[model samples]
Structure formats: structure tokens, C-alpha cells
Target: MCPEPSTSGVSPPVDAVTGIEAETDHENDAFSDYASDVSDTTSTTSSVRAYVYENGRRYHSYRPGQYLLPNDETEQDRLDMTHHVFSLTLNGDLCKTELDNPQSILDIGTGTGIWAMDIGDAYPSAEVIGTDLSPIQSEWVPPNVQFEVDDATLDWTFPENKFDFIHARTLAGAIQDWPDLVGKCYTHCKAGGQVEISEGRANFFCDDDTLDKSSKTWQWLAEFRKLSEPLGFDIAPRLPDILKAAGFEDVQLTQKHVPLGTWPKDPKLREIGRIFRVQFLEMAIEAYSLALFTRFGNWTSEEVQVLLAMVRTELKSNKIHLYTYTYLNDLKRKAESNDSNDHHSPEKRQNTLTSEAGNDDPGDEITNNLSQDSQFLAASTSGEETLPNLKNPLVSTPSKFLTDFQGRRRFLGPSSTWAYSRHVMGLIRKYLGQHQPLEIPLNTDGTAFALEFPSTKQPGTTITMQDLPSRDYAIYLINTVKFHVCQTYHLFEEQSFMQGFSKLYSEGPQPLNAENKLWYVQYFIVMAFGKALLMRGSSEVNPYGSEYISRAMELLPDVNGLYQDPITSVEICCGLSLYLQSVDHRNTAYVYVSEYLQFYRVLHELICCSLVSPFA
Candidate 1:
């Protein structure tokens, strides 16, 4: 059920700097230099056979065992941020109408495949195809989502008039000719279907009034834009006109004026913009690092690295002036296209929108054929009130309580449970949020702490914490201690903790609740200690440093035992040994080891006592 594209005449191409023969020639020279520079380096795109590259060397490059081949976490964060932006865009009325009924979708230049994956998740029934020049996406994808490593510049491989929706986003350096790409989109998009373009101007200069044009940021922006314009790809200043010219009608454009940092007048907006700045800088360092170096002929890696480091520092600082503009244009045919024969009458479409509006959830409008439950959830999370499904996704499920505790103890909580160390650690974090020094007024094993039930519970009837008895209490204590120790080890070292536990916790009906709590607590403690150690250097190590190493060793055996099912205990042991060795480098190493041994011995005794029958 694809929409028919309206047979509207294509709008004129936007040439903001048109007929300026000198400017066009200048652009040509800049592009030539940029291409030459890209080829001279011993990089992935060593041969400048193509006049342009969009994703740079990162497009096809791979490192073994890497599921996400992005340059760094910053780019990864940007990818994550796309979901946030898309959610905002998709919630709008303009997007909702088309998306609700879209049978086919095309995502052009889908990087890291995040956008496409999210769109697939949102519209499960649609045939969604994400096209990129590289095989960067994971092999495992949604049933309706598929990726093809083909250039978008080539005549699309799909049949004409196939897709109900065509989405081109962030093409920047990749899209050499915008008109041809838009024409291809127009050709492939079903009659009356929509084509949306989301693009950001690359200039780094500030749009805010706070920063002066004389700043280094101004130069950076000028140079970046100047360098890119000559490549026949600087679409930043020409986005609006480009879409209209591609035969789109009733075109709607939304410009997002995002600030670089906490410079905005509003506090919340400043925070959001600041986050964008941080993430953008992170991407710059990771993604654009080598690309920028190669693009600028005279620029060296060392120069780029130094400048990037400075830029990162500037980005983090509240003082630096910078900002960038981003835009999203949504255009649809004037009327239902010829392809959609069973078109709803305008009256029916209005009635549908009105009917959907009555449901108190936005999902009804955006998710045309989604199940009632899913629609409710999506609408609720999307923060729009238009319609409601029979079942609300936000409603809480009945808590899974554990009967294994003393004094009617329950395990499940909003974020964690009592049975897992990670959850308990999360509880500790909750405690730490309000309290300084993080010292709870409880007996070391936590058995002696007073249990406070919520008001809904029956008035206290002299319930004893000792109801678990010595054997059960001891076993619980050993498990708790082990959980804490392993989590602690993970904080100091991150690689194998989750991977190790994934094997440990995956197979059996183990104490999942308790294990999860321990993992989180371990992470918190290690992070806190690491920060303290880093702040004080070796001088601070002598005082509380030994505690870290000791905790690592104490947690190792339980972690090893946890791994006994699949992976070798030796692997965990080796990792433990390495951690211990590294921790001991500090003067507090001996003290830490001895204390950790004591903790381990205490846990051992608790477990041994639990195993022995008190009746015997």
C-alpha cells in the first residue's frame, strides 16, 4: 500500500552563490587540493580514484572482533543521539501522516546502521532498506530491515516507484551532486510518497551573539566550509532550496539552532546543547581526525592531533564560543499519488486524524498498523497525547518478590533487586547520592541492620531479622561478599567482567538478582576508588589503596566459580592475577593484599558454616 507521489513540477535548484564564475572556479581548486591530499597519505582511501568520500576511510575499514567499527565512543554517542533526534522528528504531525502508512522506506547513507535499525524497530511491517557504501552494519538485523553496500549515487538498485518514504540524512561530503540524488529519490519514491532530508551545516562558527567572529572557532569554521564548498558538496547553506527543486510539494522545513555549549540563555537548553557539543567534539576526534588531516594538504597528523586535543579541551571548557545549525525538511506530494489507487478521501483522512486524536496517544497516528500494546508504549514514551491502546505500556507489572529472605524480605525493586549484588550496589549508590563518605550505619555483613517496610505493610509485629537462621544467613553473606568483590574487580578492569558473567549467569537458574546487585556495587566502588587514587596520585595510595587490591582478590574466587560452567576458571584467575599485580605497584599493595585475604577468609568461613548443619 504505497502512496503515490504527486506529479508536481520540480522546483528550481538552489544556487546561493550562482553565476559567480570566480567563486565556482575557486571551489573547483579547493576540491582538487582536498582530493589530492586524501590520496597522498598511506590511508584506507589511498588512491583518489573517486572525486569524493562521505564516511572517509572509516566507511569500509574494519578491525577484527569489532561489532561497531566507528572511530570512537563519541561517534557512537552521536549514533545514539540520532535516536533521540529521530524520536523528536517522528513525533511531529508532518512526519506522522506519512510514516503511519508508509509501506516501504529508504535510508540513504545510513552510517553505523543505527538510524535504519531504529526506524525498523519503529515500523516493523515496512520494508526498510538502508543503503551505504560500506559493510559496517551487523549481520544480525531486524526481519524487515536489510543493508546493502551500494553507492546511492548510482541509479538505485530498487524498482522505480517502490518506496513510500525516502530518507536522506547527513550526506555532507558524500553527496557530490544533490540534484541527481534528489531526482533518483523522486524516481524511486512512489507517487504521493514523502522524501525527508536531514542535514547539518559543517561550519563551526558561532551563531550565538556571545562569540566574536575573530575567535579561532571562526577560523576553523571558515576553513572547514571553504575547504568543503569547492568539493561540490557544501549543502549546508543550500538545503531548503535543494529539496523543493527535487519535485517535492508542500515542503516544510524545521531548523534546529543548536548552541555549542552552556551559552544558551535557558539552563536546560544549555545543558542539552552542551551535551551535543561534547558528543560532536568526540566524533570530531574519532571520525574526522584522519579525514581532516588528509583533506588539508599541509596538515600533519601531529598538527591535527594537537589541534584536536586543544579543541577537545575548548569543547569541555564553558568559555569557548562555537555552534552549528541542523535542519530537517519533510516534503510530501500535494495529493495522494497515482500509485495509491485505494486512496482515502480527504474527508476520510481528516476523519482518521480526528479519530486518532481522540485516542489520547500519539502512537495511533504514527504507527498506522502497529499492535495496540506496542502503539500505547511508543506513544507514551514519545511523550505525545493523542490516543490510547487498551493496555498501557507505562503501567507497572506485579513485582517478583523473593520469599527467601528474613522478615518478609522482597528482592525486586524499580532499578534492581535484593538477591543480586549489582542491585545491592545500586542501592548503595542510592544511599551515596544523599550521603557523603558513603558509610552506612550497619553491621559489616548487613544482617544486623533494621529492616523498614513501606507503609502498605502491616504494622510491625515484633519480626526478627534473625529468622534466616545461622546457616542460611552465612550462605547469603558469602554470596553477597563475593558479588561485591567481583564487581569491585570489574571497576578497576572492565574488559572481562560482563563477558565473564554473561557465561556465568546465562546458563543456570542461578541467583540472578543477587549477582546483578553485586556487579553494580563493584562498579561503583572501583570508580570511586579510581577517582580518589587518580586525584591524589601515589601519595593517596598508601592510606586506602591496599583496600582495592584486597577486594579484587577476595572477589576473584567467586568470579572463577561463577565461570566454572563454560569458560575456564584459569582465565579469570589469570586476569585476577594481572589486576593484583598492577594494584600492588602502589606502596599500599601489601596492605591491600592482606586485607583482601582477610575478607576472603571471612567469606570462606561464612560459606563453610552455612554448609554445616547446626542441628548436627
Candidate 2:
């Protein structure tokens, strides 16, 4: 929390709706009128526009909404709060010496102009300008931080080569032309300026599954996306390219995934995500309610009121799993560095039994276990009635099965990580001790592993079957992998050289092969499983799990040939006008950044595995 500043004689706090308080205004006639007109075909679009225009106009005058975010004081206050939080979480205070001095700053879509105001306050000598279209910003602000009402789509008004820092947050569905905005940013930014953008992927879902799909909560979201998409804004996928196109060098994009309620695997993040989500719900109700009602039409006052009530109730419920990815994209021109580019040698690569951090080597322990399992499997394979030469099917089955059985066994006295591990080991031991060879295909298939036969096939036909690992062993392996990864991750979370290694790996150069790719991906998956286990015990530790789990996210570029990291290429291809550098990173100071850094490294390795592969 930031120290409360003297509002200095600013009139008793304006009764503006920001966070939870914003809901009360649903009683306003404007919202009612907007809702009633939705079913009216000809008037719907116009009504919404009128409502938006009017709201924008009214907001310029009477600030009557509540700010629900706990950090809802002022934009500047939030900025200071965000920075301090980020510094402590990421250990940025320790790395503060590495950052350049502050000067010119830019706040994109500076709602309330708080972030810029606080930044200006924090760095009294720096010149800060907050840009947004709404005239709802505070009338009186710090002398150094100024607000400008301008559409970011227009060419930036700032001089070329001017700003030293730029920041933007929560402008989902607002900016239509990201390439143009980024280009303008590029044109106006000074040599080493940094720009950041943060956003949430808006989503709506009901906890009870009892809420009607036709209910107001669902309808508003459907219409909100409907109106927003046609206007040229994509809610979920276009962030990274926008930053790259803007000409910010050395762009770094990181994602903060916020879950709606306690259902999230991580408790701390669940709480934080829930808080933001509730705040977002109220803000969305106020900010977009009129637009929704005006666009969709025919919402009776009773229906509208009920929908509002439903949304709030759903937000407080654990069953609702809505979440938004808050992206923190940080970009800056390359600062002069004395460090030489790092290249790995085969000898060094072969010596990786010990981690890069020079820690206690777990390679012997892991390999020993794998070898023991393999030898036992090999012996069993020779005596199998029909199971083929494939690897241990018993050891592999349970883990994959549990992932797919989310609803089936969740209520059973389900064993998690270690229980699953014990099961696997138990089965392995059982198989090794079996006296007689199991039949090829038995009536009950009581054997641990089984094979399927080809019915009426031609000569030389082959049979195949899948193996099931013990649930206990599967759980243990996964959790143990995650634990080691956390240990491995500690080395990179704050260390500059480790970060450098990760950045380099993200750029390219690593082995590429189907087997190796799958191996690394398996390790990554285990890391995530491990995190879920940790989350069951200590909630705060769950964020660390999110960081690891995120590494397993599918990379479109790596999989579909449709994407590439921004830093690798300077220009857009396929005549695409807009470009994005990476995810934005401004308000992300409140998020778990260290875990994300670790996630990026594993993701990079997985990508490299594919990129350098002979098959590709």
C-alpha cells in the first residue's frame, strides 16, 4: 500500500464509481433506457452510440461512480503502488542499479491519469503526459504530469524521439489500430525508451451453471464482444504483434493469468484474480452496461436488475472460472552492454547432469530411477503374452488418464502427487514379481498391461495396446518434477545472467528433434503437475506453480507456423500492416513475475526443441 498523500484541499473525494460502488448506478435512467431499446432493431445501434457518447460526456462532468479495485485511490497512487509491489516481488529494488535514470514518460489511455501522476510525483523532475479520449481525468494533477484527451489511433502528438518511458493498461477492445498506435509510439519514443501495456482477456461464466444462458450476464458479454470485434479490436490474441510494430527494441512480453474465484489451483493468485475480477465486473457493468443494453434491446428493468444481481453473485462464487490474462509487455532499445553474446559448446551441453546454476546434480538420481524402471519393463516385455516392443505402457497410462478424468474421480478419495507416484512404483514392482506370463488378451485383462489383437487381418499384421501407470507413481513423478523445476527456477528468477540465458534461448539455438522435444515437454508438464500439488498445501506457493504450468501453453508460431518472437524479426511479413512486439508489462508489478520468467525459459526450450529439430 502507498502512503496516503494530502488530497491537499481537493474537494472531499469525488463520489465517482470505480470498483464495487459502480454497481449502484444501474438504477440510472440511462442504463434503463439503453436496456429497453436493445430489441428495437432500427434504434439499437444508434441508442448504444448515443448512450456511449452521453456517458462519455457525463463522465466528463459529474464523476459519480465507485472505483472497486482496492488500489482504487488515484491512477498515480496505483502506479506508485504497482511499482513498489513489483519492486519487492521481482526483487527489482536489488536490481534498481541496473535501470537507467527516469525522464520523459508516456501513459497510454491514461484513465484518471493516475499512473502518470504518481510516476511524475515519484520522479519529480520527469515530464509525464497521460493520454486518453475520456475527459474524466482529475482536473488538478501534479505539475509534471499532464493529461491529454486524444485518440491513441491518431498520430501521437508528442515530438519524435521524445519520451523516455511509456505505459498503458486495461484498454481491451478500445484501440482499433494497434500497428498505427505502436508506430506512432515508435516514432515519438527516444533512443532507449520503454513502453508497457497491460490488459485482461474479458470473460463471463456462471458458477452454478444454473444461470440461464439467455440471462443478462451472458447477454451483455455476448453483445460486448459483438460490438467490440466489429470495430477492429481482438480481445485475446493480438497483443504481442502490436508492440513489435511500434518499433520498440528488445521487447519482452509476459502474461499474468488471473482466475475468477477460489477454483483456481493457486489460492493466492485466486484471491488476487478474484479481487480484480470483482472490480472488473463492477467497472464493466458501469462502463459497458449502457452500450450492451442499447445494442441488444428489450431488457426489462426487472431483467436488467436481476442480471446485475446475478453477475455479482457469480463473481463471489467459486464455481465461476472466469479469468483474464493481464499481459505486461516491456520494451526498450538495447542499452549498450559490455557482455559478449553467449554460445554453448557440446562439452558444456553434455555436462548438464548438474544444472546450469552449478547446483546439486539430480541427473544421477533421475537416470537411476529411469534405468531401474526400464530394466524391469524390459524383462517384463520379453515374457509378455502380446504387448509389443513399445516402452512401459503401465507407467505411462495412469498420468494421462487422470488428466482426462477431471470430473470422474475428483470426488473419490483421490490421491494426488505422491500417492500417484507410489501407485506407479507399486505396479512396477508388481509386474516384476509376476510369476507367469500374462495372456495376450484375457477375459478380464487383470494383468497390469494388455494388448489389442487385429481381428481377421492379413499375414504379418501387428497388434497394439496402451499401458496404464499406477496413479500414485504418476502423481509423485509429476509433483517431484515440479519441485525440482522450482529449485531450477530459483536460479533464473532474478539473476541477470540467467535472464540473459533465457532471452538468448528464446531468440534461438537449441536441439530440435521429436524425441527431445517430447522429452522436454514432458519435463515441463511434470513441472506444472508438481505446482498443482504444492498449491494444495500452501496457497502462496501456487503462483510459483502457475509460472511453471504456463510453460506448457501452446505456441501458435511453433505449432502452426503462424507466429514468431518479435525480437527475431524487425519487419512484418505477408503485407500485414500491424505488428506486435510482445505482451505489455506496465501494471504487472502487482503480479507474480518471477514465476513468469521461469515459465518463459521452459517455453523457450520447448520452442527451440522444435525449431532445431531435423523433422522440422
Best by the lDDT measure: 1
* Ten-residue stretch with the least lDDT total in model 2: 574-583
Best by TM-score: 1
lDDT of 2 at 295: 41
* Model 2 lDDT per residue over 1-616, tens place: 0112122211111111111111222232322211111101121132222312232323321111211111122222233323322322222221111234457878877765545654654444567887755444454455466766555755455676688776777665566545555555655666666666655454433323323454444555565556555544333335454443333455554444444433444434533443344334434454445434444455544555567676655544443344434445567744442322111122332232123323323122111111101011111111122222432322332111111122211101111232333454566567799645444332222132122222342323221111211222233334343333433332112242233324323343234333223232233344444433322211222222333323322211232232233212111110011100001111221122343344455656667645632223
Candidates in order, TM-scores: namely 0.48, 0.39
lDDT of 1 by residue, 1-616 (tens): 0111112311112211111011122222322211111101112242311223233333343222111223232343455444433333333122333454466898887765666765654454567888765454544455568876566766566887788898877777676666667667767777778888877655543322324345444444444545555654447555555544444566665554454554455443443454455446545444644554445546665666666665554455545444445556677754455433222323433443344333322231122121111111122222122112322222222112233222222222112122233334445677678533344432222132121213331222221223111221122223333333443333223344444333332342233232343442243234324322222112211322334434333333344344222122222333333333333332233444455456555655655543432221
* lDDT of predicted model 2: 0.38
Model 1 residue 106 distance off true place after TM-score fit, in angstroms:
1.1
* Regions of candidate 2 where Cα sits further than 4 Å from its true position: 1-99, 204-220, 296-305, 333-616
lDDT scores of the candidates, listed in order: 0.43, 0.38
